[model samples]
Target: MSYDSAKAAFADWGVDTETALSKLAEIPISMHCWQGDDVVGFEAKTGNSGGGIQATGNHPGRARTPDELRADLEFSYSMIPGKHRLNLHACYLDTDQNPDRDEIEYSHFAPWVDWATDQGLGLDFNPTFFAHEKADDNLTLSHPDQGIREFWIEHGKRSRDIAAQMGAALGSPVVNNIWVPDGYKDTPVDRMEPRQRLENSLDTMMATKHDKAQMLDAVESKLFGIGVEACTVGSHEFYMGYATRKGTLLCLDMGHFHPTENVADKLSSVALSVDEILLHVSRPMRWDSDHVILLDDAILQMAQELVSAGLLDRTHIGLDFFDATISRTAAWVIGTRNMQKALLRALLAPWDRLKSAENNLDYTSRLVVTEEIKDLPYATVWAEFCDRMGVPSGQSLISDLHQYQAGVSGRG
Candidate 1:
């Protein structure tokens, strides 16, 4: 069970444990900021988190201020191995000015950029299309009224600029993702008009483009949400065609598909058409419950697909779960670490051997080797990775999490 023994075992299968660890360290997962505050952003005029967006639980130590959230993020990142990026929403702007979503400027988020710069972290951005008056009807860009649609359009445009500024400041490209809750609770009489309106709105909003090095555009799709059960305007097909035509990244949220769907399978299919991909990795308990991810089959398959298809370079992995039922900081660390673990497992797989078996139609060898590798000291290798990355594993990790919870228990 020792790391040395595990390394030798993997070497016998034509896998290099050192190479796997090196590759895992290079991949950075973008952690969502909303998890710290239960998606109740620091906006002055925040509305109900409608549109199927709700974080359940009354866990103590929910971050209430920008500073507190940053502190919590700092602690979470400390426990997670390797460098990572922070995914920020426009509503999380840290500023004294009370700006509406459409009126938001880079100045409102300058503090976050400064903090990220100091911490040596990259930044990703999302335009807050929900939790606002305009989104009360579960529509924004696809709103029937031009005035309502324009309001959201302006917000989207402003978000791109802010993301570009952040990316420029950090000297890295920021992924500016757009996800709208435009859908109908009941079946719509006509879906065409709304989609057409959304298409036009997107065209107008993305007319002015920043350098790709500063910002990359991504459009996220959803199957359905709480009130929008009957219809989701930004379905996978809608955004897949849009992203393909517009040459923008397509965001495939794990929780945004049918319960039985395997999102990992879509990576290779979508990659053929789109230049880049953005993944909002999360766990869905029957629905888009946004549960903190565990090292389960779904995650393992996702990581395996990324590794097998050679999609790591073109894919951006980001965590998008907000669970307030536990220590918020711990939720971030656990989910992000699980994602890292999945990638590490995938990296250590004897991919070449498996592929050769499959290519030769050696079904028995393929099946046997795949199942046999499951018992191969993966935990031992993972522990070595944690140790090398200066993070705790096993009981030590649990103790650290509990200590953090006790420290923040007085948030009430």
Candidate 2:
């Protein structure tokens, strides 16, 4: 199973292994920082920190500070192949003085900009919307209290500014994403009130324009959360229409949809309307469990749609899972590596042949060829890609990962 052998075998079926690897290198997968710390940022805690989101498992070696999280991220990045970007939550600011969510400033994140500069990584951002006094009712931007809603609106605006600063410093466009928990636990009589408030807050926050080259704005919707079980203010329809009208990226988190629904099915419709999109790659069991990603059917289908629709450039792929059951560093490595593998698998497909079969009304041949290509020596090509990228290939990273768990991760 040499690289040359795999390349020649794929070539027989109108696929170019070399081209797939090259294209994969160009796509920057944004690795999330919260995975290294169980989503607990350095912000000084006021009250209970669990804000609808839950990270199950008490894995030791969880990072407790900004420096430790950055160190863990540095090591994890070394194991994963290809150059990538880093995704940050607003709560992860590296500053001595902790500022309230709405009061946060760009200077607080200057240290992160310096680190990204040295690592050659671009940065993306999110505004922390829950786990605060204002959101005790599980509402922030959509709260009926106009004062509370305005506070979150300011936080969202500041986050965009910080993200824009990161992009300006790193010479890349940073995507500032907003996801709030505004829902009712039990069935509420009134759902429109909260949604109306959410729409107004978004209009106010996005009213002031920022440089498009420096940053991009995105809105993420969720099906449900811990408290917001009955209804969610930012449902798919709300954000979809808002993104379409406002001209922003609509983030689609895999775990946000129902158990039976495939998130890939919504890609074509979103691509047709939104200017671009941001995808949060995660593994959800029965709900938004936030499990580490795998090379499963869901991931393959997503990659296929992205490539087949020619939406690779129009989509920003970011990892969004934090499983504390295993080594956190291993979680980062496994999830990111699997995402890259899925993208490579999709890229290596013989699209010309598949499309031609579909064009000729040869349904039987198309089905047969699609299934047959699954047995191709994809592992050989993946190993070659990792080798060429100057990283450990295959399960060889396990030995190094174990060493880090004992040495570095334990120190945290």
Candidate 3:
């Protein structure tokens, strides 16, 4: 059936497919640059993943240079149906002159701004708190050593400055996220000190004033990590209080929480407190593995909650996984496309009926309507969305990826 037929089908359920498609088109997913190289940033001479984040699988054709990474990203954006932004970690900065992370400056990323300008892509930034020598003993900002803490603080300051420049260049506010792996392998004798140090370090970093329109600061929290199994200093509770008191955006990484923890449930609660939020959507099998995102139940719930809470515009969505097990470009397309698909499905939901059923205490009707919407022509509408996007639908997108791999990424 044609997209027009699909539109009529959805309209029967009171869903304006046209409006949904338009809104979905405007929601740009921030694709992470680390995926193109399996989290091994361009500055890492040894390809060390550091900070308990490791990308499994040794897929061939990984981009080795910034130029190659950008080329792969160019091809990735082509396969994807809409405009997107690039999320760059501080470690990925260009290295014409080998400056350590502490000494790095926005000048190193001038080429990136030029490229993003040409591609018409927005930019997001992250401070690399791990995989560096300064991250002594699985601690960075929370380190007891004042010099090491100062080093990371300086890097954070510089990263925010670079993101501000990116926003100025791209005509959009940049989301600058900071997720440090500061914790203890075993139970620490003192937890308050580490948390206090982190708080102080963050104060120093955010003390540097920047235009709010140009750069928005956000801090991410993790329950635990590979090495830091005992406790994570920057726990959800810690960042929650800090974000509320300090007025910074809070980032919720899907993989950072426990397996049973529903990150979706936290959306409404956090939304009431913070002005804006950043979401790092990824799949976690057993831990923070950073697996590529799929159209799983967890993802569906996350999107539904975001839509139901009327936060589609207030929250910034970004992909945060490095699955080197598959074709790098395929990983990008799969994760990004699945993210769009989940959001579209949520948009098509009959929220009025669902909420009315809840208000009337009609549990039976609510459950029925919820299960019934699952069987709608979502795939049909998705294909139509691809058509509206002027990109290939169904398995046809695979062919485009294959052709690019043969002509471009495969060359690496």
Give the winner by lDDT.
1
Prediction 3 TM-score vs. true: 0.97
By TM-score, who's the top model here?
Answer: 1
Give the alpha carbon lDDT tens digit for every residue of 47-113 in model 3.
2344578888877788888999998998888878889999998878876788788788888998899
Candidates 1 and 3 compared: the better one by TM-score is 1
lDDT of each: 0.93, 0.90, 0.89
- Kindly list the per-residue Cα lDDT of model 1 for residues 72-131, writing each as its tens digit: 999889899899999999999998888888899999999999999999899999999989
Question: RMSD in angstroms, candidate 3?
Answer: 1.4
Give the lDDT ranking, best first. Answer: 1, 2, 3
Per-residue alpha-carbon lDDT of candidate 2 for residues 235-294, written as tens digits (9 for 90 to 100): 999999999999999999999988788998899999999989999999999999889999
Better of 1 and 2 by lDDT: 1
